[model samples]
Target: MAILTPGKPPRATSRSRSDARTRFSDRASAWLNHPMADIVLVLTASGLLLALGSIMVWSASTVFSYTQFSDAFYFMRRHLVFLGVALVAGWVTSRIPVDRLRGLGWLVFSVAGLLLALTFTPLGYGVGGNNNWLNLGGANSMLRVQPAEFAKLAIVVWGSAVLANKRRLLDQPKHLLVPFLPFSLLLIGLVVLQHDLGTAILLGGLVVAVLWCVGAPLRVLGTLAVLIAGALGTLVLANRSRVDRILGFLNPGSDLTGINHQPMQALYGLATGGWWGVGLGSSRQKWGSLAEAHTDYVLAIIGEELGLVGTLVVLLLFVILGYAGVRIALRSSTFFGRLVAAGVTSWIMMQALVNVMVVLGLLPVLGVPLPLVSYGGSALLANVMALGVLVACARDEPDAKAWLKRRATLRSKAPKRRFSAVLPGRS
Candidate 1:
């Protein structure tokens, strides 16, 4: 309250207030411009989807579990276990350097190729008519692995790494086609050979998406697009089951009790839910009406149980995730990070859209599981890892570097020396 002497220091309270305000303003500006803002959005959206998946998986799988294993929580328990493993893997993967990942592109691609090739051996286990699952367990058959699911992540990481390396040389078709084209084609061919049309389609989509994001010449993208479409069409024609699904899609009135049973039942479940749904654990269709209710068609089960509201919430979460992913890609400074962010985002979003379209009868049943939401170990693990990579990109973004530098400086500052308690040369 009194006037300060001319040579005296300002009041301690006044100095503290001013310092606090300055610090607050600095932090506010930093947060507004920080790369972590986008990453927070990504993690928040992922957490929401994962939490929702846990609840829906439990609800949808209870009936199926009870009949098969005499325990309603069997699938739920297994899914939680997988979820734990995936989250940890994602965190660890996020800590790895993007440069290292870029360097391992070809190696990762080769391993994925090897796994796909192994599907043709005697150790291959065919499920749901697709010889795509690898049998890696003992004679008791305690473990099963899906190589196709892992292939999605591998293609995105490896493919984007290749494209990012040639970012400036992308005008040349040779640069675009060299390793990415050949390796991508081989992997897609292997997945199709295993009778998995859905994964093959996703792989094809992944190539186009990555190349396009990396600014590949239009001529190159167009040529690959046509070739991919032709290959898919040919594969569809060669497979009787896929042809039937296409026919069933074209003619909804055909054979409700035959090849179309699954799709029709899925539709029936959705229609029965109407607005608010039949209530959790009260779905009539899940008892015996709809098969694969816990996997590919879990969205339909959600519609039937939690109604249109729940389904919309799931859709909204995907949209939020996609938006955050795009933002992250845009904010990334490194070519490798930018390419990876786009590639992973496209694969996950495209797969989710495909699953939803199939559930809604807009597309043929491709047997693609809903990412992060459906109950599949390999798919969940791949998705979490992909998101982990996204987090890493966000962490290394231009602004993130600045933030980290500031933090390092703070930690490096030496505390003021206190010698009052020590006598000089006492020892």
Candidate 2:
């Protein structure tokens, strides 16, 4: 390929083909080795997961939506709108500078605090025994908002900023114990008061993940773990239904018709789906056998309608997201960016795995939806925003800067020529 074009530029036939290949190779290499790879993976995986989620939401919610709202496309349409909002939010977030975003962390955290506090007031509503939702547009409007979702993002952003600032003094447990613990506890306490144990646990996990990312010592983590463990124990003792669910999770054979009904139905749906699914929307479970098919248990519907291969594909996308997110964290130049990027990534991917585990019955049902693959507006938008933060960090990676410089250099060095070639008679 390179023989004829040795010293002089050749004609546009084989030589042009060679140049195209070269350009392709250069682009591919830059993507593979540079932090830009993270951006590519983030976009690809999020798009695939969102598309699959939309299809499965439609399939799973068809019967349920019609039964409840007399419309088959109710959940599907709402989720598509949510997706559009999230994309715009993510775009705006990605455009903001990281330092500025970090500075706004406290404001975000404070706003989330206010929202969480409002959940206990008259504007708050209960669903599935949890009063963690706020009515944003009143009952007649049918618009429900979940403040806990925003709290998760708030803790991650603010916690990262706090920890990154105190990175040097973290060796002293007191320095780590001041504002971070107090702020996290305020949110967690409010969520617990809302009777949403699942969100409390998720927020607690976020706190630990942020501290761990910023290099908190073993003693501090152990101390926090013991306190959290004791709190969880207290929670289990106080709640009979939570205890029942845990016992049922331990003994899957017991109470298949009562406390175990949901998980059992999920298992049945999965069993009904063999290898290639029952063919999209043809799953028998969605007819009347499964509950929460559109929201919390959407992945179970994914398993039932899309089959094992489809489930595996969804999981693989998560793995790619995790991989890319970790790379972005490692490539980040600033401590605050790295810690926040890692915290958001951990919170998101961990929630997904936990949700998947709930469907498989490995863990007690947590009511936590899959990251970008669930049918919840607040959660879907919050997760996409967190992803936007990661994308911003990816843009600022040192390797990303270097790649940009190299591309610019190549552009400046390449020779340019006029489009007019030597005409047969005029030239």
lDDT of 1 by residue, 1-427 (tens): 7688999986778878999999999997786566578788789889999998999899989999999989999999989989999999999989888888788888878888888888899878888999998889875343677889888888888888887787777777787678888888888888988888889899899988988898877887788889888888888899888899899899987998887888888998898898899998778777877888989999999899889998898999999899878988988888889989998899889999999999999998889999999999889998999999999888878887788788879888957677766678886
What overall lDDT goes with each candidate model? 0.87, 0.87
Q: Indicate the worst ten consecutive residues by lDDT in candidate 2.
A: 136-145
Tell me the deviation in Å of residue 253 in model 2. 1.7
Error of 2 at 60 (Å): 0.7
Residue 15 of model 2 has an lDDT of 75
What tens-digit string does per-residue lDDT give for candidate 2 at 9-53?
A: 756788779999999999988768854778888889988988888
**TM-score against truth, every candidate:** 0.87, 0.88
Model 2 TM-score is 0.88
